[model samples]
Target: MAAFSRTASLLCKNAVRSESLGKLNNFCTSARGSKSYQLVVVGSGAGGAAIAARFSSKLGKGKVAIIEPSDAHYNQAMWTLVGGGIVKLEDTYRPMASIIPSTCDWIKDRATTFKPDTCTVSTQGGEEIKYEYLVVAVGLQLRYEDIKGLTEGLEMDPMLVSNYSAKYVTRTINAIDKFKGGQAVFTLPNTPIKCPGAPQKIMYLAESKWKKNGVKKSSTITYNTAMGVMLGAPKYAEVLRGVCEKRGIQVNFKTNLVEVNPEKKEAVFMKLETGETYVQPYDFMHVTPPMSTPTELKSSPLVNAGGFLTVDKYTLQHSQYPNVFGIGDCTDVPTPKTAAAVASQCGIVAENLAAVMKGGTLTRKYDGYTACPLVTSYNTCIMAEFAFEGVPMETFPIDQGKERQSMYWVKLHILPRVYNLMTKGWWSGPAPVRKIFHLGLSKQE
Candidate 1:
């Protein structure tokens, strides 16, 4: 209780500082020459945007800068719905300027190199930005080129689409609409992906769409995944397996997509255990490409042997560099990489980094809390919330593993609004709500 009170008091004092700092109108917008700040945040995705907002307010104007090359910010989570035809692609985009806090200097450039030893970052535009503290929030890079012929296939074959990419997401529904009752295949890659549930989510929605269009009896639906289990969480995995069995969806585990023959309309897969290759012909296919940390990060000294950011899974601070922190998919946190995970990590990064700035002990710790609303149909979803090691940390009192229309409603309508609030530093996930629902008995770590 004493620890909690002290941490709360520290955060309160920081909030007061944020209010005062926000009033300073001095902002930098240049991409050339050398610059410096108290803090420099790389990448402008979920983790980058939220953390930048928090510190840009807390540290004052001209004290913080964000280096990113993209002009538009996207809520990538919505791409699944967009692919399902539940929402338009335009609905998920906000101009990057609008999302970035006014107090922070937006250095519109890509980070090409990181020199943690000197607290320096080199941008592609020949600018050197130095900082007292650094936050690496650069998200994973989707490697569509990794699979043989996959890039050409996506370009030449109208039936080949992936919900993972914004360029190909809209093509998903179109391909589904064009299908005239043939083999429909969906694949999960061998590498870690942003949303582990997304590769299968589109399958469920497509199956539902086929049923609605009277093609369910004629079309065959198959889910080919690289993972041995349906989901990481055993509780949710069991339920998902039952759902697939009931829906007659064939599950092929440990099978990875290795290549796409666009001319032949076939996908080649390799078995992980036996190293055996097989081919599946398809009329329509959804592919989740392999992903990795950005090239700049992978080659840097900040990453681990696996090329992911080397941060303490609990503290989110770089193992070697005390002033360096990481968030989102780039970090080697042993949790499913999702926006929900990023939201939970944002406050931890903010508080711990603030404590570092104050020469105080880091009190906050992240428990790997993440949520995945598995949309099973047009109106039903299973809300899976868990902590480290797949321990269920549900927010509602009711059974969240069960498919419910209310959960789908929340996913469809409420999550996006909450996401926007998170980018603006106004939301910090549903921890408080979970505590209230569980009567203060919810797992804290």
Candidate 2:
């Protein structure tokens, strides 16, 4: 713990400018109605933390304020491993106070209203914050309650669980342990989820676990996805199709989870292509629910027709408000929502937003770089890194499409370390690492 503390402190110092690395308590609890900042970040998640660190260092101390309500910040990307009993939930989070730059003001509250017309927002704490530049990184909100009987099922039966939330993740392990060889069903929802591969990742893990428990012969494993393809990338999709076939895992495409009947131990799914519905009995079920921005935030003027921030897909700047930028799952970026994408977007938002603050026009663009480690088995993974339209923008010299113990080992061991650096604003995505691996020739053209 001491070594981790020392390394984290050193990294934090290097990441945050020396001037903004002090432990000065500039945070305000005053009932003051009017407060102002050079920059006000709406959420303290990955995008907000990185962008705030970027400008706080350049702008010096006390110019940045992050609006977040949580006392603990989570690296939510690791929740899948927690569900699979690979990691503990406590290991996935850190104190928000520790991750947030000490020099910046932490307005610990939820943002209730965004008046972009005046560049002002009202918080639930009854304080109003005004900003010259704003960054919105409020991640997606899960809608587990939207599905009939789902909430009750999650509460009543430990056998029914979800990897999407911390509360239900441990139940997945419990369900696996108590399984007596029936249907071990899993599902993917219709709406955009934070990590697209997470729904099925647990399925693969459960398969391995069941095989280890000697229940593989009797248990029927199934993955029901709302999308037509196994993965958004065609190359990975082709590989995953083979995995499903070889593992004898039934995959139903264009199938959506609509309802769960906890009493009957039945799960109902709607076939998106055929407009048909079916119910299947199950001893264990893992469900991923539809996700969206909070109802109020989605309906606000800050959002586009699609209920996400109306930001340019390239620049991540608001189309309507030049001074405003969007990042993370809440934005209308045409890429799969992942922590890796947010990591790449952080630098872009910081650089481009700084340009805007200097009375300059937007120039930086995001190349849609995102990574998803498809855990095909307990000990192997296929690292899928790409930009728009499934172009093979990989980081390693070796073929990333091939499942290897090396990739899986990194997924379990190294990526969590990278995520720790990322949330603390110490590390950007592997763009530099990728360039170095490509000998500086793989410049994202």
Candidate 3:
């Protein structure tokens, strides 16, 4: 840690400007700077951290500052596996200090407000940070309080579990382990979740686990979702339906979980169509909480009517404020939010942002490439890769709509390496691999 600090200090003195690397009590800095940075990024999650790493490596030290509230970041995608007892929660967390590039100014504070018109961002601690360019990637916030009795039910009831947080993640496995019999329910929220496939993934794994534990005959597994269809993409939707039918996994569409009765062990659900309501007694329930844009981005002048940062969908530039841009889950990009999407978008954003900083026209546009590894069981997964319009934009030559063990292996074994390398700005999307796999069958523009 001391070596890391010394290296950062040396880099700051020689390469970075002092004003851009603002003093924070938590951060260690010994260097001085006079010039301001070219860009400032908010948040340090998958999107913010990856983009910051890319730009800092490209632009060199003293040119970028990343303002983030939390010092720790956990991968939300792997939480399902953790709940299934396939992966540990500790395997998901990475220290923000180690992941972020040393060349970048890491502000250990949250952005309380954004004044994009003035090209300034204010921290929660009342520090004002001005920038020549800005990127918003704060991601979504989980609204656990919106659902009445949901939070209390999760905390008090041992049968209630959620993969959304590490605190409740262990409860999932415990719920499964203690299941002697009865309804094992899993729900998908009414709002847009980070990984759209996560809710169902846990259900599939739970069903498989029940069979292995010899409780399949007694337990009735139900997947209740708010959406009209099983999945957003029609191709994958059909496959999922077939799998559910073959496995006897009952799905109730348009059935949204609104409340919970922990004392009675009953879960209340609302029907979207006829304004009807129903209740089902459950032995276990896994809830995926509703999500919304971060408060700072929502209230900012840079945001749109929808409360998301308004950006040109293709170019990722702020619609109301030209100096501001957004990426990842926080922006209204009309694309699914996933780590794969962040990896692909970071490259394009970095390129366009660098061009803008040099007084040049932005040249790159995001194609809305996003990927979700739908882990079915211990060794099986379906990699659903697509674009913004819900079209099948696969990175492999094979039929991606079908579930495969190879794809599962990639998600479980390979993607972490790809993510680490890519976030460090050493790699991009798997376009090269796709081309090689398809050979002459590659699509032509």
Candidate 4:
């Protein structure tokens, strides 16, 4: 009881000091009475939730606060299967209140602006959250409306689908089911998406579905991507290319989606090679929209020219502000954004952020590790795990870039379990599994 009072008093003193000394105009007056905290985490998704759990557990009551707008938390990772009609959308979401640890204060408001210099954040409801240290895990914002006619087409019948958000993922399955013949087009947007392989993954699932429905002979499938290769890394790309060839999946490289004329059932694409525009008629279109950093973060001084948080790629610490750090898709780190990557970085972030709070040098570092479980069909997947350097960093010793039933099983069954356990501060990365599998072999060999 006494400890709680002491913590509350400290928060009050800081809140008063922040308003008086900093003279932050953006802060809301109502929150001035609620007291300030030492650490404030913005967003409560994968990266935010995990780190919040770690920090709140370490800091105890009144020390940590999470600034989130959503009432529900979701696993964006599993949306691929949801789009494939393998899993229901309802299975992907949970109440945000139930997941965040009891030790932290939950501010159910969107951060309208960030004043990093003063360590103050203003909310939509006119509340001010003052903190000594800040963690930015706001994640990316999907820009579906950026594509011409995409918004209207997506909302209407004969819906052009997307798996990027909960609102639209169900459309992917609907489009696939309705396709009897003609072009079933799937696209990869030019922007950085959370799961780079997801666009093609759904295409494979649709192709498999077409075959199952006995429409394979009549239907034509196409995967148009802006990227030069099927994947970023060479090792995995080699395997993925083979899969495309074997599956008879049409691959169009450097082709980007620019517009959708749903009334005519036409999709317009820009060819990077010839600078030519082409319109193709489609029976079903699965669109992957452009993405960018959240509005508030992009406008702040914290983000770079690319509209992503400028953090040290290895340390997950802000380039300019030592007290501020970022993890997940929001950061300008040169790693593929995925929930698997967020999971691997959580321990490093938790340890390093704690060190920063205690006025200690950062002891832990986050390698640009990301894992993508490439679901090829309903019952098969290729688990591709790699780091920044492009050496295969698989947890299992066997070849990981190959399609396997076991990998599919893991993706459907084990991965979700690990996600639930890990988010609650239980599981770390697969470092132990890696060590156990490769006892004799050198990391390089």
Best by lDDT: 1
Whole-model lDDT, model 4: 0.84
Ranking by lDDT: 1, 4, 2, 3
| Colliding pairs, model 3 | 16-62, 18-33
Error of 4 at 192 (Å): 0.6
TM-score of each: 0.92, 0.91, 0.90, 0.91
lDDT values for all models: 0.89, 0.83, 0.80, 0.84
**Could you tell me how far off, in angstroms, the CA of residue 97 lies in candidate 2 after the best superposition?**
1.1
- State the lDDT of candidate 4 residue by residue for 192-216, as single tens digits: 8888989989988998999889987
Model 4 residue 218 CA deviation in Å: 0.9
For model 3, the stretches where C-alpha displacement exceeds 4 angstroms are 1-36
Clashes (N, CA, C under 3 Å) per candidate: 0, 0, 2, 0
* Per-model root-mean-square deviation over C-alphas: 8.3, 9.6, 7.8, 5.7
Candidate 3 shows a clash count of: 2
- Of candidate 2, the 10-residue stretch with the lowest lDDT total is 23-32
Q: Highest TM-score: which candidate?
A: 1
Q: Candidate 1's residue-wise lDDT over 1-445, tens digit each?
A: 5764455445433433353222111111111127978889999899999999999988899999999999999999899899999999999999999988999999999999997644579999989897767899999999999999999999999999999887889999898888889899999999999989999889999999999999889988999999999888899999999999999999999999999999999999999999999999999999999999999999999998989999999999888777789999999999999999999999899999998777677899999999899999999999998889998888889999999999999999999999998998877789998889888986664
As for candidate 2, its clashing pairs are none
- Model 1 clashing residue pairs (backbone): none
